[model samples]
Every structure is written in structure tokens, then in C-alpha cells.
Target: MNIDFEINIYHEDYHNAGSASSEIKKYLTQLGLNPKFIRKIVISSYEAEMNIVIHSLGGKLKLDIIGNHIILTSIDKGPGIRDIKMALTEGFSTASKKVREMGFGAGMGLPNMKKNSDKFEIKSSPKGTIVRLSWVIE
Candidate 1:
């Protein structure tokens, strides 16, 4: 069975930061996915959602279940990353002081997202950014 889920994420929507990831968790639970796998998915989803909320203008989190594989994607609209390499490093973030005061930006989001996924890819430009994370269920 193939399934797809998508959620729109708004910029600086701190109150609703993890909603998308929660929805993903609910759906994964309903689908009877293994708890271990679900944990990874949820962690990645939360990180992705938080990144979109804190960093981008706006974006969408898309989850696709194709047979035994799963793909989770984040597509944001504009004001992209200036340095992919630095962004991937832990403790490297461009979060505003206000955002940091809220304890939401530790610069670990991208690194955690990539670490939790079986496969990860990120592309960014002045226009936008896209992150794709994939996992295969055994």
C-alpha cells in the first residue's frame, strides 16, 4: 500500500512547532509500524518541522509510504541556507537571539534529522530549501 501525508508549516509558529510530527506519529502508529522505527521517524519529523517553523518563510512536510519504504520530505519557500556544510554541523546555527532565548534553536536539528534517517539529502539556494529523508522497513 502506498500512502502520502502532507502538512503546511508556517514560519516562527512556535506554538504549533511539533504538530506535524505528532500527526506523523499518529499515522505511523495506526499503520502498525514498529515502535523503534516510529521513534526515528518522529524525531526526524519533529526536527524537520521545527526547522521549517524557525528558519524558512513557510514549508510543507510530506510523508510518503511506498511498499516497504518511507520517505519524509520538507520543502520550504525562500530565504534559504547560505552554507550547507556549516548548517549540517552540530552547534552551528543562525537562529536569532529571540529564538535562542526560547530554547528552540541549538543548531542540532539538521544533524539529528540526518542521523535518524536511513537516507538523507538536502538542497538549498537563495530561493528555497528541500530536505528528503528516507527509511526502509525490514
Candidate 2:
């Protein structure tokens, strides 16, 4: 079966930052996706979802399940990262003080997402940013 869906995410919407990932988890569970794959997928999805809330002006979290591949893509609008390399570093972050106070922004989001996915790709510009994570079911 193939599944595709998207959740719109707003800027600084901490209250709903995790909703997209949570919904994805429900679908994966209902589909009986492997537990090991679910864990990584959820992790990457959560991180990507959170990044949109914490950084971009607005964005959407998109999920696509095609055959044996599960992919999650976060596409955000405006104010892209100044330094992709630094952003991918384990301890680097540009999140605001309020976000840090909210117990996020410890700077592990990108690295964690990358580590948990079978394939990861990112593209950014002043106009927007996109992070794509893919996992395969064995």
C-alpha cells in the first residue's frame, strides 16, 4: 500500500510541534510497520517537525510510504539556515532563547534525524529549506 499525507506547521507553534510526528506514528503502528523502523522514522519525523516550528516562518511535514520505502520531508518557508554545516553539527544551534528555555534547542535535531534515517538530504536558500529523510523496510 502507498500512503501520502502532509501536516501544516506554523512558526513557533510549540504546542503543535510534535503533532505531525505523532500522527505518523499512529499510521505506522496501524500498518504494522516494523518496530525498529518505526522508532527511527518517528525520531526523524519529530526532529524535522520540531525544526519547522522552531526555525521557519511556516512549513509542512510530508510523509510518503511507497513500497518498501518510507519518507518524511519537511519543507519550510523563509529564513533558511545561515550555515548548513554548522546546523548539522551535533552541538550547534541558532534557536532563540525562548525556544531553549522551552527545553528544546540543545542542537541535536539535525544530527539525530540524519543518524536515524537510511537516507537524508537537505537543501536551503534564503527563500526556504527542505529536509528529506528516507527509511527502507527490510
lDDT (0-100) at residue 75 of candidate 2?
Answer: 97
Q: Among all windows of ten consecutive residues in candidate 2, which has the lowest summed lDDT?
A: 12-21
Q: TM-score for all predictions?
A: 0.97, 0.96
**Highest-scoring model, lDDT:** 1
lDDT of 1 at 110: 96
Residue 44: error of model 1 in Å?
0.5
Model 1 C-alpha lDDT per residue in residues 1-138, reported as the tens digit of each score:
899979999998988889999999999999888999899999999999999999999999999999889999999997999999999999999999999999978999999999999999999998899999999974
Model 2 spans > 4 angstroms off: none
Q: How many pairs in model 1 have backbone atoms within 3 A of each other, for residues 3 or more apart or on separate chains, i.e. clashes?
A: 0
What lDDT score is found at residue 36 in candidate 2? 85
